[model samples]
Target: MDAFGDGNFEQSEIDPAAEFLAREQNALAGLEDEIPPLPTGPVDDDVTQPKAEDGNDDFSGYTVPKQVTEEPERIRKWREEQKTRLEEKDREEERKKEELREQARKELEDWYKHHEEAISKTKAANRESAKNAEKQFVAETDEIEPGTEWERIAKLCDFNPKTNKSSKDISRMRSIILQLKQNPISTNKKV
Candidate 1:
């Protein structure tokens, strides 16, 4: 070696570089010893949250799932009440109609039994007999009067309003008289 005097680099010069590499490798190994080891198998996932036992809660006071409700029971009860009310109303209407019908039937029966004897009287439909009329209906009990009760009652009960002539109109007076003569009830009776 031209030693330090001349420009020659020998094995000794390269030895320091090798020593530096070895020291660095040892330091790295030491650092690795202090580090945690890598897992070789699947990590455990058995973590579980405990349920509230003593009923005590954490910071947010343990929010539970919200509950839902239905009002079908209430609605069903309301419907039942409404149905009962409606049924009662219908019954009342029927009772009123029945009362009116009975009164009419009694009046007719009395009239027929007394005046229209021997003949089985029948009913006819007439516009005059409509319950909604603004005027009081009157008729001759003994004679066949125009717009009278006997004729009106006969036509009112026996005739079909859909086809019969109007009682107020005079043109149908002949048909009304003829109709009374042809009536089975009047024909059957002596009067």
Candidate 2:
């Protein structure tokens, strides 16, 4: 416990470092109060003005004379004539393009009408060829051979030949399941 004014501490004491810091802070405040005040000067804008000789008023170069309007009128008339000619040329080009487009459309329609039978004949020929290819493929590979593939599968999976009874061939899914179960994992997995 500590007293506020002219009192003594009974239980707790102020730390020496804390007391020294408090005294140092008070001493710094006293020093600051004793220092002289700083002087102030005027701002820069009050002492400076822009000069005309520095080229700020450069409108004198762009000031148009009385005769300037006359020459521009002549140039404007000339440009108007040129613009008219260009517009006429554009209309002519558009008309020519329209005629050419019509001619191309007529030619395409005539060609389609004239060669319609030929197009149908070619498509039918292609369809017939595809059907023949499919028939040849079916004839060649309709039955599985009894040698290598059948023999290996017979040895591995179902091998009861004396009674003449065995399970059907393994399906695609069954083959994948067997391969996954038999092949070891770890580094044996395909890279």
Among the numbered candidates, top TM-score falls to 2
lDDT tens digits, residues 82-151, model 1? 9999999999999999999999999999987876553423222334345434343333334555444455
lDDT of 2 by residue, 80-114 (tens): 99999999999999999999999999999999987
What are the candidates' C-alpha RMSDs? 23.6, 29.9
> TM-score of every model?
0.23, 0.28
Alpha-carbon lDDT, every model: 0.60, 0.64
* Candidate 2 TM-score, true structure as reference: 0.28
- Alpha-carbon shift of residue 140 in model 1 (angstroms): 36
